[model samples]
Target: MVLPIVKLVILLARQITRPVVHRLGALAKRNRTFRSVIVPIGQGYHSMNFTSQSRLFGVDTQTQAEPLSTDEAMNLGSKLLGEVLVYGVSASFLLYEYHKSSRKEKIKAKNRQNEKAELQGKIQEYWDVTEAEIALLKRKIFELEVKNHS
Candidate 1:
Protein backbone atom coordinates (compact mmCIF):
# COMPACT_ATOMS: atom_id res chain seq x y z
CA MET A 1 0.00 0.00 0.00
CA VAL A 2 2.63 2.48 1.09
CA LEU A 3 5.09 1.52 -1.68
CA PRO A 4 2.54 2.07 -4.45
CA ILE A 5 1.58 5.43 -2.95
CA VAL A 6 5.21 6.42 -2.74
CA LYS A 7 5.82 5.38 -6.35
CA LEU A 8 2.80 7.40 -7.46
CA VAL A 9 4.02 10.47 -5.59
CA ILE A 10 7.47 10.13 -7.10
CA LEU A 11 6.04 9.67 -10.59
CA LEU A 12 3.94 12.78 -10.21
CA ALA A 13 6.85 14.85 -8.91
CA ARG A 14 9.10 13.71 -11.76
CA GLN A 15 6.41 14.56 -14.31
CA ILE A 16 6.03 18.03 -12.86
CA THR A 17 9.76 18.71 -12.62
CA ARG A 18 10.69 17.49 -16.09
CA PRO A 19 9.25 20.39 -18.09
CA VAL A 20 10.87 23.00 -15.84
CA VAL A 21 14.21 21.23 -16.14
CA HIS A 22 13.89 21.16 -19.94
CA ARG A 23 13.01 24.84 -20.05
CA LEU A 24 16.02 25.68 -17.92
CA GLY A 25 18.28 23.58 -20.13
CA ALA A 26 17.00 25.19 -23.34
CA LEU A 27 17.79 28.64 -22.01
CA ALA A 28 21.40 27.78 -21.26
CA LYS A 29 23.98 28.95 -23.84
CA ARG A 30 26.17 25.87 -23.66
CA ASN A 31 25.78 23.04 -26.14
CA ARG A 32 23.90 20.04 -24.87
CA THR A 33 24.62 16.41 -25.73
CA PHE A 34 22.12 13.72 -24.92
CA ARG A 35 22.10 9.96 -24.47
CA SER A 36 19.21 7.80 -23.36
CA VAL A 37 19.12 4.70 -21.20
CA ILE A 38 16.71 2.04 -22.39
CA VAL A 39 14.58 0.19 -19.88
CA PRO A 40 12.61 -2.88 -20.97
CA ILE A 41 9.06 -2.98 -19.67
CA GLY A 42 8.33 -6.55 -20.82
CA GLN A 43 6.44 -7.80 -23.90
CA GLY A 44 8.42 -5.64 -26.31
CA TYR A 45 7.65 -2.34 -24.62
CA HIS A 46 10.58 -0.10 -23.76
CA SER A 47 11.04 3.14 -21.84
CA MET A 48 13.92 5.53 -21.94
CA ASN A 49 15.40 7.25 -18.91
CA PHE A 50 17.40 10.38 -19.60
CA THR A 51 20.22 11.60 -17.44
CA SER A 52 21.77 15.01 -18.16
CA GLN A 53 25.32 15.59 -17.10
CA SER A 54 27.22 18.74 -18.05
CA ARG A 55 30.89 18.63 -18.97
CA LEU A 56 32.90 21.46 -17.45
CA PHE A 57 36.65 21.57 -17.08
CA GLY A 58 37.66 23.36 -13.87
CA VAL A 59 39.50 26.38 -15.40
CA ASP A 60 37.44 26.44 -18.58
CA THR A 61 34.23 27.03 -16.61
CA GLN A 62 35.59 30.33 -15.27
CA THR A 63 37.08 31.44 -18.62
CA GLN A 64 34.42 32.35 -21.16
CA ALA A 65 35.70 31.57 -24.66
CA GLU A 66 34.23 33.42 -27.64
CA PRO A 67 31.59 31.47 -29.50
CA LEU A 68 32.91 29.88 -32.67
CA SER A 69 31.99 31.39 -36.05
CA THR A 70 29.83 29.10 -38.19
CA ASP A 71 32.73 28.34 -40.58
CA GLU A 72 35.10 27.56 -37.71
CA ALA A 73 32.62 25.27 -36.02
CA MET A 74 31.89 23.51 -39.32
CA ASN A 75 35.60 23.01 -40.13
CA LEU A 76 36.19 21.59 -36.70
CA GLY A 77 33.66 18.89 -37.46
CA SER A 78 35.87 17.39 -34.84
CA LYS A 79 34.16 19.68 -32.35
CA LEU A 80 37.38 20.06 -30.37
CA LEU A 81 38.18 16.44 -31.32
CA GLY A 82 37.15 15.78 -27.72
CA GLU A 83 33.50 15.30 -28.68
CA VAL A 84 34.45 12.72 -31.28
CA LEU A 85 36.67 10.95 -28.76
CA VAL A 86 33.93 11.04 -26.15
CA TYR A 87 31.43 9.62 -28.62
CA GLY A 88 33.88 6.94 -29.76
CA VAL A 89 34.56 5.82 -26.19
CA SER A 90 30.89 5.88 -25.27
CA ALA A 91 29.94 3.87 -28.39
CA SER A 92 32.61 1.28 -27.62
CA PHE A 93 31.39 0.97 -24.06
CA LEU A 94 27.78 0.59 -25.17
CA LEU A 95 28.75 -2.12 -27.67
CA TYR A 96 30.68 -4.03 -25.04
CA GLU A 97 27.81 -3.77 -22.59
CA TYR A 98 25.35 -4.99 -25.23
CA HIS A 99 27.56 -7.99 -26.04
CA LYS A 100 27.86 -8.85 -22.34
CA SER A 101 24.10 -8.63 -21.88
CA SER A 102 23.50 -10.89 -24.92
CA ARG A 103 25.97 -13.43 -23.56
CA LYS A 104 24.19 -13.38 -20.22
CA GLU A 105 20.83 -13.85 -21.93
CA LYS A 106 22.15 -16.89 -23.84
CA ILE A 107 23.48 -18.33 -20.59
CA LYS A 108 20.11 -17.77 -18.89
CA ALA A 109 18.25 -19.50 -21.75
CA LYS A 110 20.63 -22.48 -21.61
CA ASN A 111 20.15 -22.77 -17.84
CA ARG A 112 16.37 -22.73 -18.24
CA GLN A 113 16.58 -25.55 -20.80
CA ASN A 114 18.82 -27.57 -18.48
CA GLU A 115 16.39 -27.10 -15.59
CA LYS A 116 13.40 -28.22 -17.68
CA ALA A 117 15.28 -31.30 -18.92
CA GLU A 118 16.26 -32.13 -15.34
CA LEU A 119 12.60 -31.93 -14.29
CA GLN A 120 11.54 -34.19 -17.18
CA GLY A 121 14.14 -36.74 -16.09
CA LYS A 122 12.68 -36.73 -12.58
CA ILE A 123 9.18 -37.63 -13.82
CA GLN A 124 10.54 -40.32 -16.18
CA GLU A 125 10.30 -43.06 -13.58
CA TYR A 126 6.51 -42.91 -13.60
CA TRP A 127 6.34 -43.55 -17.36
CA ASP A 128 8.93 -46.32 -17.07
CA VAL A 129 6.87 -48.05 -14.36
CA THR A 130 3.71 -47.70 -16.37
CA GLU A 131 5.37 -49.32 -19.42
CA ALA A 132 6.60 -52.23 -17.30
CA GLU A 133 3.10 -52.74 -15.85
CA ILE A 134 1.64 -52.73 -19.37
CA ALA A 135 4.04 -55.45 -20.55
CA LEU A 136 3.26 -57.59 -17.47
CA LEU A 137 -0.48 -57.20 -18.06
CA LYS A 138 -0.10 -58.32 -21.69
CA ARG A 139 1.88 -61.43 -20.66
CA LYS A 140 -0.69 -62.34 -18.01
CA ILE A 141 -3.52 -61.95 -20.50
CA PHE A 142 -1.71 -64.25 -22.93
CA GLU A 143 -1.32 -66.86 -20.16
CA LEU A 144 -4.98 -66.59 -19.20
CA GLU A 145 -5.96 -67.15 -22.88
CA VAL A 146 -3.82 -70.33 -22.93
CA LYS A 147 -5.53 -71.52 -19.79
CA ASN A 148 -8.93 -70.85 -21.28
CA HIS A 149 -8.03 -72.78 -24.39
CA SER A 150 -6.82 -75.73 -22.33
Candidate 2:
Protein backbone atom coordinates (compact mmCIF):
# COMPACT_ATOMS: atom_id res chain seq x y z
CA MET A 1 0.00 0.00 0.00
CA VAL A 2 2.74 2.46 0.96
CA LEU A 3 4.68 1.44 -2.12
CA PRO A 4 1.76 2.34 -4.35
CA ILE A 5 1.35 5.70 -2.62
CA VAL A 6 5.06 6.41 -3.05
CA LYS A 7 4.84 5.55 -6.73
CA LEU A 8 1.85 7.83 -7.13
CA VAL A 9 3.71 10.70 -5.44
CA ILE A 10 6.73 10.19 -7.69
CA LEU A 11 4.53 10.15 -10.76
CA LEU A 12 2.81 13.34 -9.70
CA ALA A 13 6.12 15.06 -9.04
CA ARG A 14 7.42 14.10 -12.47
CA GLN A 15 4.24 15.32 -14.08
CA ILE A 16 4.57 18.68 -12.36
CA THR A 17 8.28 19.18 -12.98
CA ARG A 18 8.63 17.73 -16.48
CA PRO A 19 7.31 20.76 -18.37
CA VAL A 20 9.59 23.20 -16.53
CA VAL A 21 12.65 21.00 -16.95
CA HIS A 22 11.92 20.35 -20.62
CA ARG A 23 11.51 24.07 -21.30
CA LEU A 24 14.79 24.91 -19.62
CA GLY A 25 16.55 22.14 -21.49
CA ALA A 26 15.16 23.39 -24.77
CA LEU A 27 16.33 26.89 -23.96
CA ALA A 28 19.80 25.67 -23.14
CA LYS A 29 19.97 23.65 -26.35
CA ARG A 30 18.97 26.72 -28.37
CA ASN A 31 21.57 28.91 -26.64
CA ARG A 32 25.10 29.69 -27.88
CA THR A 33 26.63 27.41 -25.28
CA PHE A 34 25.27 24.33 -27.03
CA ARG A 35 25.44 25.75 -30.55
CA SER A 36 29.21 26.27 -30.50
CA VAL A 37 29.76 22.57 -29.86
CA ILE A 38 26.84 21.04 -31.77
CA VAL A 39 27.19 23.17 -34.91
CA PRO A 40 30.86 22.48 -35.52
CA ILE A 41 30.61 18.80 -34.80
CA GLY A 42 27.54 18.38 -36.99
CA GLN A 43 29.13 20.33 -39.84
CA GLY A 44 32.35 18.37 -39.58
CA TYR A 45 30.54 15.06 -39.77
CA HIS A 46 28.46 16.19 -42.71
CA SER A 47 31.51 17.45 -44.57
CA MET A 48 33.40 14.22 -43.90
CA ASN A 49 30.50 12.15 -45.20
CA PHE A 50 30.10 14.31 -48.28
CA THR A 51 33.81 14.25 -49.11
CA SER A 52 34.25 10.54 -48.64
CA GLN A 53 31.28 9.66 -50.81
CA SER A 54 31.65 12.26 -53.54
CA ARG A 55 35.39 12.85 -54.02
CA LEU A 56 36.85 9.47 -53.08
CA PHE A 57 34.83 7.67 -55.76
CA GLY A 58 35.73 10.03 -58.69
CA VAL A 59 33.39 12.11 -60.89
CA ASP A 60 33.20 9.75 -63.94
CA THR A 61 31.59 6.95 -61.92
CA GLN A 62 27.78 7.06 -61.81
CA THR A 63 27.83 5.62 -58.28
CA GLN A 64 29.84 8.61 -56.91
CA ALA A 65 29.02 11.64 -59.08
CA GLU A 66 29.35 15.25 -57.98
CA PRO A 67 26.48 15.84 -55.56
CA LEU A 68 26.07 19.61 -55.83
CA SER A 69 26.90 22.35 -58.37
CA THR A 70 28.93 25.46 -57.41
CA ASP A 71 25.82 27.62 -57.46
CA GLU A 72 23.86 25.09 -55.46
CA ALA A 73 26.62 24.90 -52.83
CA MET A 74 26.83 28.71 -52.60
CA ASN A 75 23.07 29.02 -52.19
CA LEU A 76 22.96 26.31 -49.52
CA GLY A 77 25.83 27.85 -47.61
CA SER A 78 24.20 31.27 -47.69
CA LYS A 79 20.91 29.85 -46.45
CA LEU A 80 22.63 27.99 -43.64
CA LEU A 81 24.61 31.08 -42.67
CA GLY A 82 21.47 33.14 -42.57
CA GLU A 83 19.74 30.54 -40.39
CA VAL A 84 22.67 30.47 -37.93
CA LEU A 85 22.72 34.27 -37.69
CA VAL A 86 19.01 34.44 -37.03
CA TYR A 87 19.18 31.70 -34.43
CA GLY A 88 22.11 33.38 -32.67
CA VAL A 89 20.35 36.73 -32.51
CA SER A 90 17.13 35.17 -31.25
CA ALA A 91 18.95 33.14 -28.60
CA SER A 92 20.82 36.19 -27.36
CA PHE A 93 17.56 38.07 -27.09
CA LEU A 94 16.03 35.19 -25.12
CA LEU A 95 18.97 35.18 -22.71
CA TYR A 96 18.68 38.93 -22.21
CA GLU A 97 14.95 38.68 -21.55
CA TYR A 98 15.52 35.88 -19.06
CA HIS A 99 18.06 37.98 -17.15
CA LYS A 100 15.74 40.98 -17.18
CA SER A 101 12.87 38.93 -15.79
CA SER A 102 15.07 37.52 -13.01
CA ARG A 103 16.23 41.00 -12.04
CA LYS A 104 12.67 42.22 -11.87
CA GLU A 105 11.75 39.27 -9.65
CA LYS A 106 14.64 40.06 -7.30
CA ILE A 107 13.53 43.67 -7.03
CA LYS A 108 9.98 42.62 -6.30
CA ALA A 109 11.21 40.22 -3.59
CA LYS A 110 13.29 42.92 -1.96
CA ASN A 111 10.36 45.32 -1.92
CA ARG A 112 8.13 42.70 -0.33
CA GLN A 113 10.73 42.04 2.37
CA ASN A 114 11.03 45.72 3.15
CA GLU A 115 7.29 46.09 3.35
CA LYS A 116 7.04 43.14 5.73
CA ALA A 117 9.75 44.57 7.98
CA GLU A 118 8.00 47.94 8.11
CA LEU A 119 4.71 46.29 9.05
CA GLN A 120 6.43 44.30 11.79
CA GLY A 121 7.99 47.49 13.20
CA LYS A 122 4.60 49.22 13.23
CA ILE A 123 3.05 46.29 15.11
CA GLN A 124 5.80 46.42 17.73
CA GLU A 125 5.34 50.17 18.15
CA TYR A 126 1.58 49.74 18.60
CA TRP A 127 2.14 47.16 21.33
CA ASP A 128 4.65 49.38 23.11
CA VAL A 129 2.24 52.36 23.13
CA THR A 130 -0.58 50.18 24.41
CA GLU A 131 1.61 48.90 27.26
CA ALA A 132 2.62 52.44 28.20
CA GLU A 133 -1.00 53.59 28.33
CA ILE A 134 -1.89 50.68 30.60
CA ALA A 135 0.98 51.54 32.94
CA LEU A 136 -0.16 55.23 33.13
CA LEU A 137 -3.76 54.18 33.93
CA LYS A 138 -2.50 51.94 36.75
CA ARG A 139 -0.47 54.79 38.22
CA LYS A 140 -3.51 57.11 38.09
CA ILE A 141 -5.64 54.54 39.90
CA PHE A 142 -3.03 54.15 42.68
CA GLU A 143 -2.86 57.94 43.22
CA LEU A 144 -6.70 58.15 43.46
CA GLU A 145 -6.77 55.31 46.00
CA VAL A 146 -4.16 57.05 48.20
CA LYS A 147 -6.19 60.33 48.11
CA ASN A 148 -9.42 58.49 49.08
CA HIS A 149 -7.66 56.74 51.98
CA SER A 150 -6.35 60.09 53.26
Candidate 3:
Protein backbone atom coordinates (compact mmCIF):
# COMPACT_ATOMS: atom_id res chain seq x y z
CA MET A 1 0.00 0.00 0.00
CA VAL A 2 2.76 2.38 0.95
CA LEU A 3 4.71 1.37 -2.14
CA PRO A 4 1.79 2.14 -4.41
CA ILE A 5 1.26 5.56 -2.82
CA VAL A 6 4.96 6.31 -3.22
CA LYS A 7 4.80 5.24 -6.86
CA LEU A 8 1.77 7.45 -7.42
CA VAL A 9 3.56 10.41 -5.90
CA ILE A 10 6.63 9.74 -8.05
CA LEU A 11 4.47 9.41 -11.17
CA LEU A 12 2.74 12.69 -10.39
CA ALA A 13 6.06 14.41 -9.74
CA ARG A 14 7.44 13.25 -13.10
CA GLN A 15 4.35 14.48 -14.92
CA ILE A 16 4.72 17.88 -13.28
CA THR A 17 8.49 18.07 -13.83
CA ARG A 18 8.50 17.13 -17.52
CA PRO A 19 6.92 20.39 -18.70
CA VAL A 20 9.08 22.51 -16.43
CA VAL A 21 12.18 20.72 -17.71
CA HIS A 22 11.21 21.42 -21.31
CA ARG A 23 10.62 25.12 -20.61
CA LEU A 24 13.90 25.43 -18.76
CA GLY A 25 15.72 23.72 -21.59
CA ALA A 26 14.23 26.17 -24.04
CA LEU A 27 15.19 29.08 -21.81
CA ALA A 28 18.72 27.78 -21.44
CA LYS A 29 19.02 27.49 -25.20
CA ARG A 30 17.93 31.10 -25.71
CA ASN A 31 20.06 32.64 -22.90
CA ARG A 32 23.81 32.35 -23.33
CA THR A 33 24.71 33.22 -19.74
CA PHE A 34 22.15 30.78 -18.39
CA ARG A 35 23.39 28.18 -20.82
CA SER A 36 26.97 28.68 -19.66
CA VAL A 37 26.00 28.23 -16.03
CA ILE A 38 23.59 25.33 -16.51
CA VAL A 39 25.39 23.28 -19.13
CA PRO A 40 28.45 22.41 -17.04
CA ILE A 41 26.37 21.71 -13.99
CA GLY A 42 24.10 19.49 -16.08
CA GLN A 43 27.07 17.70 -17.55
CA GLY A 44 28.63 17.16 -14.17
CA TYR A 45 25.40 15.78 -12.74
CA HIS A 46 24.98 13.50 -15.74
CA SER A 47 28.56 12.24 -15.40
CA MET A 48 28.13 11.51 -11.70
CA ASN A 49 25.63 8.77 -12.48
CA PHE A 50 28.30 6.60 -14.14
CA THR A 51 29.61 3.37 -12.51
CA SER A 52 33.06 4.98 -12.09
CA GLN A 53 31.65 7.64 -9.77
CA SER A 54 29.43 5.05 -8.10
CA ARG A 55 32.63 3.55 -6.74
CA LEU A 56 33.44 6.80 -4.90
CA PHE A 57 30.53 6.27 -2.50
CA GLY A 58 31.84 2.78 -1.53
CA VAL A 59 29.97 0.83 -4.18
CA ASP A 60 31.70 -2.46 -5.05
CA THR A 61 34.48 -1.74 -7.55
CA GLN A 62 38.12 -2.75 -8.09
CA THR A 63 39.48 0.73 -8.83
CA GLN A 64 40.67 2.77 -5.83
CA ALA A 65 39.99 6.57 -5.98
CA GLU A 66 40.98 9.40 -3.70
CA PRO A 67 38.37 10.68 -1.29
CA LEU A 68 36.86 14.11 -1.91
CA SER A 69 38.53 17.22 -0.44
CA THR A 70 36.86 19.10 2.41
CA ASP A 71 35.38 21.83 0.20
CA GLU A 72 34.22 19.34 -2.41
CA ALA A 73 32.64 17.17 0.27
CA MET A 74 30.88 20.15 1.83
CA ASN A 75 29.57 21.31 -1.56
CA LEU A 76 28.33 17.84 -2.45
CA GLY A 77 26.66 17.40 0.92
CA SER A 78 24.88 20.77 0.71
CA LYS A 79 23.71 20.10 -2.84
CA LEU A 80 22.36 16.70 -1.79
CA LEU A 81 20.66 18.21 1.23
CA GLY A 82 19.09 20.95 -0.89
CA GLU A 83 17.77 18.41 -3.36
CA VAL A 84 16.27 16.25 -0.59
CA LEU A 85 14.57 19.25 0.98
CA VAL A 86 13.14 20.42 -2.33
CA TYR A 87 11.70 17.01 -3.19
CA GLY A 88 10.35 16.51 0.32
CA VAL A 89 8.53 19.85 0.24
CA SER A 90 7.16 19.19 -3.23
CA ALA A 91 5.83 15.75 -2.26
CA SER A 92 4.25 17.17 0.88
CA PHE A 93 2.48 19.88 -1.10
CA LEU A 94 1.19 17.38 -3.64
CA LEU A 95 -0.11 15.07 -0.91
CA TYR A 96 -1.89 17.97 0.78
CA GLU A 97 -3.61 18.99 -2.44
CA TYR A 98 -4.59 15.43 -3.19
CA HIS A 99 -6.12 15.08 0.26
CA LYS A 100 -8.00 18.35 -0.08
CA SER A 101 -9.49 17.52 -3.48
CA SER A 102 -10.53 14.05 -2.35
CA ARG A 103 -12.26 15.51 0.69
CA LYS A 104 -14.16 17.93 -1.54
CA GLU A 105 -15.23 15.10 -3.85
CA LYS A 106 -16.50 13.08 -0.89
CA ILE A 107 -18.56 16.01 0.31
CA LYS A 108 -20.01 16.50 -3.16
CA ALA A 109 -20.97 12.85 -3.41
CA LYS A 110 -22.67 12.90 -0.03
CA ASN A 111 -24.67 16.00 -0.96
CA ARG A 112 -25.78 14.42 -4.23
CA GLN A 113 -26.95 11.32 -2.37
CA ASN A 114 -28.93 13.42 0.06
CA GLU A 115 -30.55 15.32 -2.79
CA LYS A 116 -31.51 12.10 -4.54
CA ALA A 117 -33.15 10.77 -1.39
CA GLU A 118 -35.03 14.03 -0.88
CA LEU A 119 -36.32 14.00 -4.46
CA GLN A 120 -37.50 10.41 -4.08
CA GLY A 121 -39.39 11.33 -0.92
CA LYS A 122 -41.08 14.26 -2.72
CA ILE A 123 -42.14 12.02 -5.61
CA GLN A 124 -43.66 9.52 -3.17
CA GLU A 125 -45.63 12.28 -1.47
CA TYR A 126 -46.98 13.48 -4.81
CA TRP A 127 -48.03 9.95 -5.76
CA ASP A 128 -49.94 9.57 -2.46
CA VAL A 129 -51.79 12.84 -3.02
CA THR A 130 -52.78 11.85 -6.56
CA GLU A 131 -54.11 8.48 -5.33
CA ALA A 132 -56.22 10.18 -2.66
CA GLU A 133 -57.76 12.57 -5.21
CA ILE A 134 -58.64 9.67 -7.54
CA ALA A 135 -60.35 7.82 -4.64
CA LEU A 136 -62.42 10.92 -3.73
CA LEU A 137 -63.60 11.28 -7.35
CA LYS A 138 -64.63 7.61 -7.45
CA ARG A 139 -66.78 8.02 -4.27
CA LYS A 140 -68.53 11.08 -5.73
CA ILE A 141 -69.37 9.14 -8.94
CA PHE A 142 -70.86 6.27 -6.85
CA GLU A 143 -73.22 8.68 -4.93
CA LEU A 144 -74.43 10.25 -8.24
CA GLU A 145 -75.16 6.76 -9.62
CA VAL A 146 -77.26 5.89 -6.47
CA LYS A 147 -79.24 9.14 -6.80
CA ASN A 148 -80.03 8.46 -10.46
CA HIS A 149 -81.18 4.87 -9.70
CA SER A 150 -83.51 6.04 -6.85
Candidate 4:
Protein backbone atom coordinates (compact mmCIF):
# COMPACT_ATOMS: atom_id res chain seq x y z
CA MET A 1 0.00 0.00 0.00
CA VAL A 2 2.77 2.46 0.93
CA LEU A 3 4.70 1.61 -2.23
CA PRO A 4 1.74 2.44 -4.48
CA ILE A 5 1.20 5.72 -2.63
CA VAL A 6 4.91 6.62 -3.05
CA LYS A 7 4.75 5.93 -6.78
CA LEU A 8 1.67 8.11 -7.15
CA VAL A 9 3.39 11.00 -5.34
CA ILE A 10 6.42 10.70 -7.58
CA LEU A 11 4.24 10.86 -10.68
CA LEU A 12 2.50 14.00 -9.36
CA ALA A 13 5.83 15.66 -8.69
CA ARG A 14 6.96 14.97 -12.27
CA GLN A 15 3.70 16.44 -13.61
CA ILE A 16 4.17 19.63 -11.57
CA THR A 17 7.77 20.23 -12.70
CA ARG A 18 7.22 19.22 -16.35
CA PRO A 19 6.08 22.70 -17.44
CA VAL A 20 9.06 24.38 -15.73
CA VAL A 21 11.45 21.99 -17.53
CA HIS A 22 9.83 22.70 -20.88
CA ARG A 23 9.93 26.53 -20.38
CA LEU A 24 13.63 26.45 -19.47
CA GLY A 25 14.18 24.32 -22.51
CA ALA A 26 12.30 26.75 -24.78
CA LEU A 27 13.90 29.93 -23.33
CA ALA A 28 17.35 28.50 -23.90
CA LYS A 29 16.33 27.53 -27.40
CA ARG A 30 14.98 30.97 -28.44
CA ASN A 31 16.96 33.65 -26.57
CA ARG A 32 20.75 33.80 -27.01
CA THR A 33 21.09 35.56 -23.63
CA PHE A 34 20.30 32.40 -21.61
CA ARG A 35 21.97 29.88 -23.97
CA SER A 36 25.23 29.54 -22.07
CA VAL A 37 26.13 26.39 -19.99
CA ILE A 38 22.54 25.12 -19.39
CA VAL A 39 22.00 23.53 -22.81
CA PRO A 40 24.30 20.62 -23.44
CA ILE A 41 27.21 21.18 -25.88
CA GLY A 42 26.42 20.23 -29.49
CA GLN A 43 22.95 18.89 -28.72
CA GLY A 44 20.91 20.08 -31.68
CA TYR A 45 17.16 20.55 -31.36
CA HIS A 46 14.43 18.91 -33.43
CA SER A 47 11.56 21.25 -34.49
CA MET A 48 9.48 22.29 -31.46
CA ASN A 49 6.42 20.21 -30.75
CA PHE A 50 3.73 22.83 -31.56
CA THR A 51 1.76 22.92 -28.27
CA SER A 52 4.74 23.38 -25.94
CA GLN A 53 6.44 25.95 -28.19
CA SER A 54 3.21 27.94 -28.56
CA ARG A 55 2.72 27.93 -24.80
CA LEU A 56 6.34 28.99 -24.24
CA PHE A 57 6.68 31.75 -26.83
CA GLY A 58 3.04 32.77 -27.10
CA VAL A 59 3.37 36.40 -28.30
CA ASP A 60 6.48 36.03 -30.41
CA THR A 61 5.13 33.21 -32.59
CA GLN A 62 5.95 33.59 -36.32
CA THR A 63 2.69 35.51 -36.81
CA GLN A 64 3.41 38.73 -34.83
CA ALA A 65 7.09 39.57 -35.27
CA GLU A 66 10.66 38.59 -35.80
CA PRO A 67 13.41 39.92 -33.47
CA LEU A 68 13.78 43.71 -33.23
CA SER A 69 16.25 45.29 -35.67
CA THR A 70 18.64 48.18 -34.90
CA ASP A 71 16.40 50.76 -36.64
CA GLU A 72 13.39 49.71 -34.62
CA ALA A 73 15.34 50.10 -31.38
CA MET A 74 16.39 53.65 -32.30
CA ASN A 75 12.83 54.71 -33.19
CA LEU A 76 11.54 53.35 -29.89
CA GLY A 77 14.17 55.30 -27.95
CA SER A 78 13.32 58.60 -29.67
CA LYS A 79 9.61 58.17 -28.97
CA LEU A 80 10.38 57.61 -25.28
CA LEU A 81 12.57 60.75 -25.17
CA GLY A 82 9.76 62.93 -26.56
CA GLU A 83 7.34 61.57 -23.95
CA VAL A 84 9.82 62.47 -21.18
CA LEU A 85 10.10 66.05 -22.38
CA VAL A 86 6.32 66.53 -22.39
CA TYR A 87 6.05 65.20 -18.83
CA GLY A 88 8.83 67.57 -17.61
CA VAL A 89 7.09 70.65 -19.00
CA SER A 90 3.71 69.67 -17.50
CA ALA A 91 5.32 69.15 -14.07
CA SER A 92 6.94 72.59 -14.14
CA PHE A 93 3.61 74.30 -14.90
CA LEU A 94 1.90 72.48 -12.02
CA LEU A 95 4.67 73.48 -9.59
CA TYR A 96 4.36 77.16 -10.59
CA GLU A 97 0.58 77.17 -9.97
CA TYR A 98 1.05 75.52 -6.56
CA HIS A 99 3.48 78.26 -5.42
CA LYS A 100 1.17 81.03 -6.68
CA SER A 101 -1.82 79.74 -4.67
CA SER A 102 0.35 79.38 -1.53
CA ARG A 103 1.47 83.02 -1.84
CA LYS A 104 -2.18 84.16 -2.15
CA GLU A 105 -3.07 82.19 1.01
CA LYS A 106 -0.30 83.96 2.94
CA ILE A 107 -1.58 87.40 1.84
CA LYS A 108 -5.18 86.53 2.81
CA ALA A 109 -4.12 85.42 6.29
CA LYS A 110 -2.18 88.67 6.86
CA ASN A 111 -5.22 90.78 5.91
CA ARG A 112 -7.45 88.80 8.33
CA GLN A 113 -5.04 89.55 11.20
CA ASN A 114 -5.16 93.29 10.47
CA GLU A 115 -8.99 93.36 10.24
CA LYS A 116 -9.34 91.62 13.64
CA ALA A 117 -7.12 94.21 15.28
CA GLU A 118 -9.10 97.11 13.77
CA LEU A 119 -12.51 95.77 14.84
CA GLN A 120 -11.72 94.50 18.37
CA GLY A 121 -11.46 97.87 20.15
CA LYS A 122 -14.65 99.26 18.51
CA ILE A 123 -16.65 96.13 19.42
CA GLN A 124 -15.52 96.22 23.10
CA GLU A 125 -16.59 99.88 23.49
CA TYR A 126 -20.07 99.19 22.05
CA TRP A 127 -20.69 96.26 24.41
CA ASP A 128 -19.63 98.22 27.52
CA VAL A 129 -21.91 101.22 26.76
CA THR A 130 -24.89 98.97 25.99
CA GLU A 131 -24.51 97.04 29.27
CA ALA A 132 -24.38 100.21 31.42
CA GLU A 133 -27.61 101.64 29.86
CA ILE A 134 -29.48 98.32 30.32
CA ALA A 135 -28.62 98.23 34.08
CA LEU A 136 -29.84 101.82 34.70
CA LEU A 137 -33.23 101.18 32.95
CA LYS A 138 -33.88 97.99 34.95
CA ARG A 139 -33.24 99.81 38.30
CA LYS A 140 -35.68 102.64 37.36
CA ILE A 141 -38.45 100.16 36.44
CA PHE A 142 -38.07 98.27 39.78
CA GLU A 143 -38.32 101.44 41.88
CA LEU A 144 -41.47 102.62 40.05
CA GLU A 145 -43.21 99.26 40.55
CA VAL A 146 -42.39 99.23 44.32
CA LYS A 147 -43.94 102.68 44.87
CA ASN A 148 -47.12 101.73 42.99
CA HIS A 149 -47.54 98.58 45.12
CA SER A 150 -47.08 100.52 48.41
The global C-alpha lDDT for each of the candidates, from Candidate 1 onward, is 0.51, 0.63, 0.68, 0.57
Note the residue pairs that clash in candidate 4: none
Candidate 1: tens digits of C-alpha lDDT, residues 30-65: 343321111111111211111111122233233334
- Evaluate residue 137 in candidate 3 and report its C-alpha lDDT on the 0 to 100 scale: 92
Q: RMSD to the native, candidate 4?
A: 21.6
Preferred candidate (lDDT higher): 1 or 2: 2
Top lDDT prediction, candidate number: 3
Cα lDDT over the full model 1: 0.51
Task: Write candidate 4's Cα lDDT for 26-110 as tens digits.
Answer: 5555666555433322121112333347668775456523333333333333333334444565568779999999999999999
Cα lDDT tens digits for candidate 2, 30-83: 675644544554455456567676766674333532345433433343345444
User: Would you estimate the TM-scores of all the predictions?
Assistant: 0.41, 0.48, 0.53, 0.40
Model 4, poorest ten-residue lDDT window? 39-48
For 1-150, candidate 3 gives per-residue lDDT tens digits of 899998997787666655555555566667777666555554454445545577767777654444454334334433443455558879789899999999999999999999999999999999999999999999999999999999
| Cα error, candidate 2, residue 10 (Å) | 38
RMSD of 1: 16.6
For TM-score, candidate 2 versus 4, the one ahead is 2
- By TM-score, the better pick of 1 and 3 is 3
Lowest-scoring 10 consecutive residues by lDDT in candidate 2?
A: 69-78
